[model samples]
Target: MSIDRVVEQIRTSVFSYKKLADRLAERPSERVRAMIYLKEIAAEYNLGTIEKFKNLLSFTLVKLYDDIDFSLPTGLDLERIVKENNVVFVPNHQSHADYLILSYVLFDRFKFIPLIAGGINLNIFPIGDLFRKSGCFFIRRSFNNNILYKLTLEAYISHLLSSGHAIEFFYEGGRSRSGRLLPPKYGMFQILIETHSQLDPAVRRPLLFIPISIVHEIVPEQGALTRELEGL
Candidate 1:
C-alpha cells in the first residue's frame, strides 16, 4: 500500500470522532467536556501533510546520522517466521532516534513498515505530526478511569494483530534517560499478553517476540540528558 493510504488508515484507526464520542458516552457526565477537548485535538491533527513528513523525516534522519547501524543477524531466517506468525518487536529504548533508525531499516530491508502505539502529546506540531504519519497511533498515558478509552485501545491493538500486522513497542515504555537498562515497565507489552487468547487459534501458537537492541558508541543526547537529570 502507498504511504498516504496507510497513513490515512492509521490516522482514522486512532482518531475517529464518532468512535471517540460513542466511547465517551459511556461516562455520561464527562461527555460534553471530553467532546470539546476531542474536537480541538481532531482539528489539530492533519493527515494531508503527513506523507511528505514521513519521507522527509526518514531521509533527513538517515543523512544526518552516519554512525547509526544495527546488531541484527546477517542470515537469520526471520522472513519465513514473519510470514507465518504475527510478530511483536520488543526493543530496548535508548534514544529518540531509535524509532527513526528502526523505521529506516525496515523501509530499506523489507519495504514494509509496522504500526506502533505512541503518546498523543507527541501529536502536537511538526515533529509530532511527522511521527503520526510514520505509522504511530497516539494514546493518552493516564486513562483517567475511562473504561471507554481502555477498551478502544485494546480493540485497536487486537485488530492490528489479527490482521497479521507486525507490532512493536518499547519494552521500557520510553528511554532510560539516566543511562541505565530499566526494569521492564511492561506498559504496551501487556496488551499483547492480555489479549493472546483472542488471537486466531490456528496462527496464535507463537507470537514472535523479536528482542532488538540498537546502540551508539557516542550518544548524541548525552549532554541534554545530563542537564535534564540535574534539573536544568
Candidate 2:
C-alpha cells in the first residue's frame, strides 16, 4: 500500500475514532477537530518503507562496522514463524545505529523488513526524512495525558499487527547510558497487550516477542555516554 493510504488506514480505523468520539461526546464540535488532529498525527507517523532505499542504506550501514556477528541458532525456523505470527522485535538500545542495523540484517538474511518504532526526538531534519523512508515511525516521548494521541498510537499499532506487518521497538525506551541493561519502560508493552486483548479471537494473530541482545565491543556513542554519565 502507498504510504498515504497506510496512514489513512490508521487514521480512519474504527478502533480509535469510535472511542475518541465517545470521549468528546459532550463537545460535538471537538469530534471533527479531533479527527483532523488524528489525521495529522497519523500522517506524521507514516512508514514509507521503500525497498530500494532500504537496500542502498543497508549497504552503507554495513560498512560502518568491522563485522556484525548475527546468529540464530535456536533452530526454531524463524522464517516459518514469521509467516505464521506477528513478530515484535524487542531489542536493547545501545546506539542510534542500532535501528538500521537490525532491519538491515532482517532483510538481508530473512527477506523481511519490519517497521521500527522510533522516538519523536529523532525526527529532525534530513536524517529524519531518511529514517521515515526506511520505515521508522516517530512516536512522542510521552502522551499518557493526551487521550487523543494515546488512542491514535494504540490504534495505529493495532492496525499494523492485525494487518500482518512485523515491527521492532526498543524495550529500554532509549539508549542505555551505563553500558548495562536498564529497567524497561512498560508503556509500549501495555499498549500492545491491551490492543491484542481487544482484537477478535478469529482475527487476532499470535504476537511473538523476540528479544534480541546486541553487544557492541566499542559502542559508537561510548564517548558521549561516558561524558553524560560523569555529569558533563
Candidate 3:
C-alpha cells in the first residue's frame, strides 16, 4: 500500500479519532498542528529505490568485508510464515553495517524488504533522504517526555503492520560496542504489544517475531568503538 493510504488509515484510527476530536473541541490550531506533525513523521517505502540501492550497498559490502554468510535456522519455513503473518525481525546489534547487510540479503533472496527503525541521529542531509526512500524510518533516540511523538510513531507502526509490511529493528537499540550482545530494549516490543491488543481480534493476523544473529569477523566500526571505550 502507498504511504498516503497508510497515513490516512492512521489519521482515522480509533486512537486518533478521540485525540483529534478532543483537540478540535479544545483548540482548532492544535488539531491542525497535530495532523501536520503526523504527516511529517510517516515514512514511505519506495520499492524502486530500494532495489537500486541494494546493488550499491552490495558493492560497498564487498569492498568492506572478506565475505558475508547468510543462513536461516532449520525448518524456519520463511515463505509460508510471511504469507500468513506480519513479520517483525529482531536482530542482534554488532556494527552499523548490520542493517545494510540484513536488508540487502532479504531483498536479494526473498524479495522481502522490511521497514527498518533507525535513530534520528543518522537523519542527515543526503544520506537521510536516501535511507528514508529505502525503507528506513527515523526515530528519536529518547522520547520519554513527548507524548504526541510517541503516539504518532505508534500509529504509524500499527498501520504498517495492518497493511502487511515487514519490520526490522535491532533489539539492542544501538550497535554493540563490546562485540557482545547487549540487553534488549523493551520500547519497540511494548509498542508492538499494545498495537496488537488494540486490533480487533477476529480480524487481526498473527504477528510473529523472528530473531536473527549476525556474526562479523571484523566490525567496520572497530576503530571508533575502541576510541569511544577509551573516552577519546
Error of 2 at 183 (Å): 1.0
- Off by more than 4 A, model 1: 1-59, 202-205
Candidates 2 and 3 compared: the better one by lDDT is 3
Q: Write the per-residue lDDT of candidate 1 for residues 135-163, one digit (tens) a residue.
A: 66677777748665565566566657666
Best by lDDT: 3
lDDT of 1: 0.63
TM-score for each prediction? 0.73, 0.84, 0.87
Tens-digit lDDT track for model 3 on 1-232? 5645645766776234343356456765665655655665666677888888998987887889878888987888887888788789999998888888898998999998888999888778888877877888888888889766676677677767776788888999998856898889999999887776666566568989999988887777888889988999
**Candidate 3 wrong stretches, greater than 4 Å:** 1-28
Q: Write the per-residue lDDT of candidate 2 for residues 151-180, one digit (tens) a residue.
A: 767767777777777888899999975468
- Which candidate number maximizes TM-score? 3
Q: Judged by TM-score relative to the true structure, which candidate is superior, 1 or 2? A: 2
lDDT of 3: 0.78
Hey, what RMSD does candidate 3 come out at?
Answer: 2.8
Ranking by lDDT: 3, 2, 1
Give each model's whole-structure lDDT. 0.63, 0.73, 0.78
